[model samples]
Target: MAKRPKVNPNEMSFLDHLEELRWHLIRATLAVVVAGIFAFIAKEFIFDIVLLGPKQPDFITYQILCDVAKSVGLDESFCYTEIPFSIQNRTMSGQFSIHMWTAITAGFIIAFPYILYEFWRFIAPALHENERKASRGFIIIASLLFFIGVLFGYYVISPLSINFLGSYQVSEEVVNEIDLSSYMGLIRASALASGIVFELPIIIFLLTKIGLVTPQILKQYRKFALVGILIVSAIITPPDIASQIVVAIPVLILYEISIFISRMVLKKERKEKIEVKSITKN
Candidate 1:
């Protein structure tokens, strides 16, 4: 392969920018693929422990839920010795397909920080020097929020959902023999959805910086946002009130943090503009 010439981002044409973006994407994809290979190799851990954990009664989440329920004098549905449902591979190649896709999802989650870094590098050139410096911790903060969200989903949301859905049956005659793909899909959706939702603060920061959002607007629409969050929580979690509340709390907290972040961003921008004006007058 020929050596790609070094070109300044400021002087780059549309095609040059496209080429740059392509390389960034390629590197990000390679990172995911590499991480996926490791996850694939660790199939025993991934499948038996991580993926199948919620089905087991002795899982940490279930134990905690049992304790909490007992203390709070609430329903002890979570204290069951076993989940009644069984996971099965109905179709030929079902297990292999689930394994492959699960590995890829694992890879994406593990490689998320590097993916963020690649994304930041692509956009960094367009930002002013001070802007880049101010947001230097972007990748770290975003990654931290994402990982925290994943843990919350895995530990809280996934367990609650799996317990309720896996145990619920229309009749005693109908056994809950969930397909392998379907079970994996629920786990993936819960974790990824929560992780993405936790990026609310970062999204708000960017929107505020670009003058598209204000703290006032977020405050004014707080009621609507709460409704939306509850709706989202309901969709992802079981039909029970406790489950929905558990899911909504963190998201609502994140929304409030987003509002604070937006306020700070605007304050910083105002201070910068005043300094610029003073400098111009001087």
Candidate 2:
């Protein structure tokens, strides 16, 4: 591979920047492909155990909900012996397609940190030394948040949606036999969406850096954010208040944390500016 052209921070050409970005993207893609291959080899564990686990009644999320219902003296409808729906593949090549896609998704999720590292490497050279140091935990924190969101989606959101949708019926004549592709699609969507959503803090950090967002703005728009969060909760969770609230709580918490992160970024920026001014005066 040709060496990426170096771009001076103050006088870098647009073409030079593009060349640097291309190499970073190439590395990131290679990492994902390698991770995907590993996932492909672990098809049995990924599909039978991890993907289908949410459909089982003994899943931990269902168990916890059952306990909650019992404690509240409510109906134990959640404590199901089995989901009413059966997953089937109608297309001749559906199974193979799903396997390939699922492995790719798994690879992306597993290799997320390395991907972020490549992205950071591409951008770090442009940042001041202090800025780079300040963001040293970027990869680790981002990866942790992503994995936590994945777990949340798999254990909470996926099961709730699957159970509700699978068992739901408007008419007794209807039988709920879900397509295999549809089932896997739901799992993939929920997991990936949650993973991205969990990057709120990092998003806020960048927005703060760019002066596009501030703690005040977040606070001022708190009500709107709450409404948006509820809407997102409704989309991700089952059409039940309990499930919506369960999903919304963590998101709201993340929003609050984002506000704090923005405040910290602003504080640091202000302190740095003051020091710079003081040095100039001296």
Candidate 3:
């Protein structure tokens, strides 16, 4: 691909920046729409084979969990014959709305790289050439982290939550029946939230670059961050020690990774500054 000529932000009018941003947004939207079209067309594959995969008893996660539980001489808590729930549509238009929105969500996920490219394009011109070079793999790294988080949420969090909540009985008086919209919402939220959470290191990198945060500050607040992460874990997963631990472990790892990223960014900034000083002295 031919390199894009960098625009000098100092010479560009405010209106010009807005105009450039508009087209980037337009292209991002187009990419999502095109991906959504495919999601809509392959509704069965997306819905039955992918989205509803966790809801089935035969899911890999359930099988693995069952094996571990049985080996430990505990109840095979996850060995469900079937998820004790039925997902239903309550409204006349609920199914259609669900279809459209689900497709859009899938579209956004599939076309995320393109969207990130547009986002980078919008901001790249404003950054120093060296900064842009340093961030050349931002989109790829971000996408990879996001997809990993999605898989984690799908394979770990979703099944954990679904199995616990699905089988939980309140005196066996209430049968579990979930609305289609509700189940879909849970799946989407878990996936997207985890995806965003996994971008902690990237966020830390940006914040460190802009002088808003540092490795020292992160270390200083380590205890508080631990508490906050626990609370977040409770919110995302079932209110249980095991579930919370499962969700929090990766997030804690990400936080530690963010500290490392911050240290690296700060070190690089200092080196660059020293180089500038040496150049001026010469």
Cα RMSD to the true fold for all candidates: 1.1, 1.6, 2.6
Backbone clashes in each candidate structure, one number apiece? 0, 0, 0
Where does model 3 exceed 4 Å of error?
Answer: 1-8
**Which has the better TM-score: candidate 1, or candidate 2?**
1
All candidates' lDDT scores?
0.94, 0.91, 0.90
Off by over 4 Å in 2: 1-12
> Cα RMSD (Å) between model 2 and the true structure?
1.6
TM-score of each: 0.98, 0.95, 0.95
Model 1 pairs in collision? none
Candidate 1 ranges with C-alpha deviation above 4 Å: 1-3
Decoy 2 TM-score against native: 0.95
Pairs of colliding residues, candidate 2: none
Q: Provide the global lDDT of candidate 3 against the true structure.
A: 0.90
In the range 99-122, model 1's lDDT, one tens digit per residue, is 899999999999999999999999
Choose the strongest candidate by lDDT: 1
* TM-score, prediction 3: 0.95
Q: For model 2, how does the per-residue alpha-carbon lDDT over 231-271 read when each residue is reduced to its tens digit?
A: 99998888899889989999999999999999999999999
